[model samples]
Target: MRSDYLGFSCLLSAVILQATAVLAADDDVLKRGAYLMNGPVACGNCHTPVGPNGPDLSKELAGGTPFDFPEFMAFSANITPDPETGIGSWSDDQIARAIREGIRPDGTVIGPPMPIEFYRHLSDDDLKAIVAYLRHLAVVKNEVPRSTFNIPLPPNYGPPIVSQGSPSPDDKIAYGGYLVAISHCLECHTPRGSDGHLDMKRAGAGGNSFPGPWGVSVSRNITPDLEDGIGSWSDDEIKAAITTGVRKDGTHLMPPMAFGYYANITGGDLDAIVAYLRTLPPQKTTN
Candidate 1:
C-alpha cells in the first residue's frame, strides 16, 4: 500500500510538470508569433483598412483594403477570427496553406498581389507562429468583397510546398535573405517586364512605380551600385531608411513601404538585412 501511494504521487507530479512545460512552450510560440506578425511580417499593412488619415488600427486585421491595378481589382480579405466573416472556421493547417500555397480551404486560388511566392519560403515554425498569431486576433466582423483579375491567375503558384525551413541567424547573409524573401521586399522593388514578370537578373534594380493617395513613389535601386544603390550608404543609414522611411539624403520616403511595421524589426535582424543587401551585385536603376 505504501509503495502504490508513492508511485501514484510520482505519476501525478510528473504529469503536472509535463503540463507546465507544455504551457510554457505554447507561451513562447505565441510571443514569437506576435513579434513576427507585428514586426517583419506586417500582414496589417495590406489586410487592415486605410482611411483618409492612414490605416485604421481600430479595425486591425479586419481587412478590406483595395488594390487596383491595370490587371485586377483586389480587395484584401478579412483575416480576423470572426466565424461568420473572417477565418474563425479555418483550421490551423488551412490558414497555413492559404498563406503559403494561396489555396483557400474551399479550393479557390488566392490571387496577386498576395505574394504567396515569397511566403512559400517561410519556415514551418514561422508559419505556425503566424497562424497562431492570427488565430488569437480580436474577431472583427467585416465582409470583404472578392477580387477580380482580368489576367488569368495560374491554377496554382507552384508545386505544393512539401516542407520549408529557415536559415540560422548565425549565417547572417542567408538569414537576411530569408527575411527579405518572406517580407517580399523585391515584390515591389524589382521592375517588371512587358509580360509583368519580375526581371530576376536585375533583382534589386528598383524602378517599380506605385501610385496612390500619396502620389507616385518609385522604388529606388537597392543594389550595391556606388551611384544608383546603397553602396555609398553606411549600414546605419540603410537601417534608418528601412525603419524610419528616411533616405540617406534626409528626405522622407513615400507610403506603401510599411515603415511602421518595419520599425519593430530587431537590431540583429536589421544587421542581417544590411549584410544581405551588401552582397547584391550593383545594378543601375531600370528605365
Candidate 2:
C-alpha cells in the first residue's frame, strides 16, 4: 500500500509539470499573436470602425468600415466572438480556413481588399496563434453587411494548403520576404493590370491611388530605382516612412498606410524589411 501511494504521488507530480509547460506554451502563443495583430499585421486598420477621433477602441475589431470601390462595396466583418453576429461560433479550423484560404465555413469566397493572397503564406503555427488570440477576445455583438463584387471571385484562392512553414529569422532576406508577403505590402503598392489583377512583373513599382477623407493618396514606388524609388534613401529613412508615415523630404504620408500600427514593430523586424526592400530591382513607377 505504501509503495502504491508513492507511485501515484510521483505520477501526479509529473502530470502537473506537463500541464504547467502546456500553459506556458499557450502564453507565448498569445503574446506573439497580440504583437502581430496589433503591430505589423494591423488587422484593425481596416476592421475597426473609425469615428471623429479615430478608431473606436471600445468596439475594437467589431468591424463596419466600408471599402467603397468601383468594383464592390464591402463592409469589414465583425471578427469579435459574439455568438449572435460575430465569429463566436466558428471553430479554430474554420477561422484558420477563412483567413488563409479566404473561404468561410459555408463555402463562400471572401472578396478582395481582404488580401487573402498574401495571408495564404502564413505559417501553420502563426495561424494557430492568431486563431487562439481571436478566440479569447471579448465578444462584441455587431453585424456587418455583406460585400457585393461586380467582378467574380475565383473558385478558390488556390489549392488548399496541406502544411506551411515560415523561413527562419536567421535568414534575414528570406524571412523579410515572408514578412512582406504576410503584410501584403505590394498589394496596394503594386500597379494593377487592365483586368484589375496585380502585375507581378512590375511589383513594387507603385501607382495605385486610394481616396478617403484624407483625399487621394498614391502608393509611391518602393523599388530600387534611384530616380523614382527609395534607392537613395538611407535605411533609417525607409524605416521612418514605414513607422511614422514621413517621407525622406519630411512630408507626412497620408492615411490607409497604417503607420500607427507599424510604429509598434520591433527594430529587428524593421531592419529585415529595409534589407528586403533594398534588394528589389530598379523600376520606375508607371505614373
Candidate 3:
C-alpha cells in the first residue's frame, strides 16, 4: 500500500512538471511574437482599422481599412482569431504558407500591399511564433471587403516560394536591409512609370507620388545623394524622422508614411536601418 502511494505521487509530480514546461515555452513564444508584431513588423498598422487621428486601438487587428493604389484596392483582413471573420479556422500550415508564399488556402494569389515577398524571408521559428501569437488573439468579428484589382494581373504576379534565411539582427547592414525589404520601403519610395512598373535603375531616388486628402505627397529621395537625399542627415536625425515624423528642418511628414508604427522600434533596429541607408548608391532626384 505504501509503495503504490509513492508511485502515484511521483507520476502526479511528473505530469505537473510537463504541463508547466509546456506553458513556459508557450509564454516565451508569445512574448517574441508580440514584440515582432507590435514593433519592427508593425502588423497592427495595416491590420487595425484607422480612426480620424490614427489606428483605432479599440478595434486592434479587427481590419476594415482600405489601401488604395493605382493597381488595386486592398482591404486589410481581420486577424483576431475569430472563426467567422478572422483566421481562427485556418490551419497553422495555411497561415505560414500565406505569409511565406503569398498563396491563400483557397489557392488564390494574395495580391499586392500584402508584402508577402519580404515576409517570405522570415525564419521558421519566427513564423511559428507569429502564428502562435495570432491563434491566441481575442476574437473580434469584423468582415473586410475582398481586394479588387483595377488592371489584369500578370501570369506570374505573385512571388515564388523561396527559402532565403533571415539575417541576424546583430548584423547592422544586413539586418537593416532585411527590415527595409519587409517594410516595403521601395514600394512607396521608388517611382513607377505610366504603366505602373517601378524604374529599378533609379531605386531610392524617391519621386513616387501619392495623392490624397493631404495633397500630392511625393516620397523623398532616401539615397546617398548630398543635395536631394538624406545623405547629409545625422544618424539621430534619421531616427527622429522615422519615429517622430519630424524632419531635420522641423517639417512634419505627410500621411501614408506612418511614423507612429515605428516609434517602438528598438535602438538596435534603428541603427541597422541607418547603416543600410548609408550604403545606398547616391542618386539625385527633384521632389
Give candidate 2 misplaced runs (Cα > 4 Å): none
lDDT of 1 by residue, 106-125 (tens): 99999998889889999999
Q: Count the clashes in each prediction.
A: 0, 0, 0
- Local accuracy of candidate 2 as per-residue lDDT tens digits, 1-287: 99999999999999999999999999999998888888878888998889899789888889989998999898999999998789898899999999999999999999978999999999999898888888888888887888899889998999999899999989999988888888889898899998889998888999998989999999999998999999999999999999999999999999898898899999999999888988888788768
Model 1, stretches more than 4 Å misplaced?
none
Worst lDDT run of 10 residues, candidate 3, spans 154-163
lDDT of 3 at 135: 85
lDDT score, candidate 1: 0.91
TM-score quality measure for candidate 2:
0.97
Give lDDT tens digits, candidate 3, residues 1-287: 99999999999999999999999999999988887777767778779888887788777789877878867998988988898899889899888887777777887777777767567777777788888878878889898999899977553445565445778887889989987876667777787776777776777889877776678888999987889999999999999999898999999999777687788788988899889989988888955
lDDT of each: 0.91, 0.90, 0.82
Candidate 3 or 1, higher lDDT: 1
Query: Number of the top candidate by TM-score?
Result: 2
